[model samples]
Target chain A: MTGRDGGAPLEPLGNTPVVILVRPQMAENIGTTARAMANGGLFHLRLVSPRDGWPQDRAWRTASGADRILEAATVHESVDDAIADLHHVYATCPRPRHIVKTVMTARGGAAELRAATERGLKVGLMFGPERAGLDNEDMARADALIRYPLNPTFMSLNLAQAVMIMAYEWWMAADATPPRTLMTNETHVATKGELENFVSHLVRELDGCGFLRNEQKRPGMVRNLRHFFTRGEVTEQELRTLHGVVRELAHPRRAED
Target chain B: MTGRDGGAPLEPLGNTPVVILVRPQMAENIGTTARAMANGGLFHLRLVSPRDGWPQDRAWRTASGADRILEAATVHESVDDAIADLHHVYATCPRPRHIVKTVMTARGGAAELRAATERGLKVGLMFGPERAGLDNEDMARADALIRYPLNPTFMSLNLAQAVMIMAYEWWMAADATPPRTLMTNETHVATKGELENFVSHLVRELDGCGFLRNEQKRPGMVRNLRHFFTRGEVTEQELRTLHGVVRELAHPRRAED
Candidate 1:
């Protein structure tokens, strides 16, 4: 029961899995958790009885620039109300206590959440308090448990770190490893012919300068030199620079000067 | 030089890449970096001139039981001195300023560093100061760069979280990552320094030729030019080819003949 929202109820952030912090104590941790969620592109935040109570001044300060997530967060009276509308729920727990649920690694849980999001299901990712993790009663509410593969000897993950890692997994599970795109949008990628021309231009200079004078190694050196430019998949702007670079080195600012 | 540890130098903890924080600011951040390293099984920690000074009471307190790592951590006067014993190095830079190095995703980088480690190479994973990240000069020392695939819209990872995720990926890399390259190759890939030298040489020639004469726009143009070359992942042989190409074009048979 969110007491403040008047007659209407707060809704889950569409498609994205909701992050629920149950009885989290410190404002700093909550703020950092919200920041972590934003980093992983998860927006919805639901708090179940934060110990320091709601709208803590310090919380917003700790959240860095993630003010929007904290601003839209809904407070819940209980865990049951927190996940009331969710089609699926995942509780993050270290493996030893995962006897009751269909235990999955964080990676496995991320894939499950990704699938649920694609199917348009309302999903909840629950994290317990800073002092004590989810109680047995609270853990029982989840459909499955996410056991992060942490070091067995030093299993010391803070509340924000756990949420951050889980959120990272969620983002990574859905994301295709992006093909390396040239960061600048201004220039078009160079054509194969453009690259060949640049390579040929440089080779011609090498020949003239006697840099490629060794007959035994000339062809191999030429091929290797060509491969370097070809692999960059140079942009038109870069190729232009290269062409100019060759011309200038052979005959410095001869025209512009 | 670690002033406190007299006689023998503080050596890194075996084959794992020593986590080097370049001028990290706060005790809290340094403490958390150690904690994060512990969580992911990374043992070595090196501080490249921590601003607040070392052995701070607040750091160990904030580390939250990651005391052993903090205790054994070594402080260095410079980035080079910190990475002196390391055979391979990686710098993490997530944004548009990346230039003159092979760029890799955190996952991809973790696998690579892991391979280098398995081959008995001591490695270094470098992070920059909180307020300002690594300078281009500092970046020039690395074998390559590690760029985390963060949510592009909200890519605000703190110092400790950055180290944490990298450490997590390092541990995850042992079995989880697929092999790095699809093609068969023998010659070693060029290090960031080698790649950077080629970029600087070409840029100088471009400058001499007046290709980058637009003073107001030179910085961006230089960055773009470096990016074009860095993206290629040129090998040692290719780098040699490129050096010859640059030399031949600049001085030409006009000099050598």
Candidate 2:
């Protein structure tokens, strides 16, 4: 659909991550996975010896309007050949393979994939068929194991769902920032100098009042004082208010007249 | 499927979230949604006045082996009746409705749902039809909007894929930890007491060196110093090294040496 404003760009953002499905059984799932990939802006697909064979009518029908992805999908006889040109490969393993491997959550894995893409390196995410997940040999060839913290009692995830999560995370991580930006009314956040000055003033006054008695702990105390004001985005107005509050508190009382 | 441990319990984990299809039209999408739900361990499906009548043969066939979910499905004449008992309701919206609402990603939404499940509250996720998403009127009834950051160019996901993403996220968030645990053997992580003692010692040394000049700023500084050490899990060996470093730095130089 076109953007409501009618000026939205027609192109999707970022490089597409290659999705490799190994020994996938159902045509419907491959279609759905393609649909899901297209939904999240990923288009490159590689099928490794699909059980039902390729070019199935059912996948085309189920893919809805995502015919481009299905048409572009490449079929490979082996996992090695499918990811031969890819610099980074992630294997989604539902169960632990009893071997030592670096494990990452979907979010973490996507971040790494985004980084790889930024360096112009090809990246691929591999998924096993519905029944058995990636074999040890398949996983041994991958860079890392992408594991979800699924409920122990029921851990099975649909093949498409697994692909969708990784794709969504990759899209989000590759973006400039989150879509929704807080409306700040044209006011820029307070500068580091502004925050530092206010914090230093506050600390100096507190020190004069014999607040910081532990002389040996001055640096850390100052840093802590600095952090309190800098932990969040300090607005211009808020910074002024803090400066005023500090001056008022540290002011000497001339007997109330 | 049996667990790798051989005697793993057969019961599904967590409460079954209600999947309410609000005005869903396609029989295939509904069937696929059932299959996706079953894949992620959700069984309580409530159809809110589907365009096609309930007990759809297509949905059953598409559901693959998830016949139990279809057999247990419930149909309601209206959205109100469908989610009347649900304490929390999430409406999946593909586009911005231009109305004020809390928006969350699938991951955040799932975490909230898992928390609600722990509280024993009835939780329901509602999906609109394929073409036009939840209208403003339909969205008014929802507590929050579940938004996925899809590519602007191709932002549509298959209804079942949408359902599957939400379900998968819920399952992941409801679990203990990601499936694979990094092997951090032998050396235990530093205890809270160890961290606190180290921070105190460091702070005392810094204070003596005239670093923490501000008295009132001491508490915040101490907290920040402690935070720096405890931000990540520090091993026992690392903590011991930190202690030795602090002691050595604070030591007074001997004239003979």
Candidate of highest TM-score: 1
What are the per-model numbers of colliding residue pairs? Answer: 2, 17
Task: Report the lDDT tens digits of candidate 1 across residue range B1-257.
Answer: 00111222223335777899999888899899988887777878899898989889989888867787899899999998999889989888765363434677778888888889999988889998886788888888987777776566666788889998998888777635221221214566678988888888888888887888999999999998787887645677777888889778877887787
Q: Give the CA lDDT, 0 to 100, for residue B182 in model 1.
A: 16
DockQ of each: 0.06, 0.11
For every candidate, the chain B TM-score is 0.62, 0.65
State what share of the real interface contacts each candidate retains: 0.14, 0.22
Q: What TM-score do all the candidates reach, one by one?
A: 0.69, 0.61
Q: Model 1, which residues run further than 4 Å from truth?
A: A1-13, A177-257, B1-14, B81-88, B97-103, B119-122, B140-145, B175-257
- Cα lDDT tens digits for candidate 2, B1-257: 11222234333345767998888888888888876776566878888778889888888777655567778788898888998898999888877644545677777788888889889998999998777777777788988788876776566576887887787777667555553334335566668888777777888889998889899998898778777877656666667888888777778356336
How far is A238's C-alpha from truth in model 2 (Å)? 28
Q: What is the lDDT of residue A228 in candidate 2?
A: 73
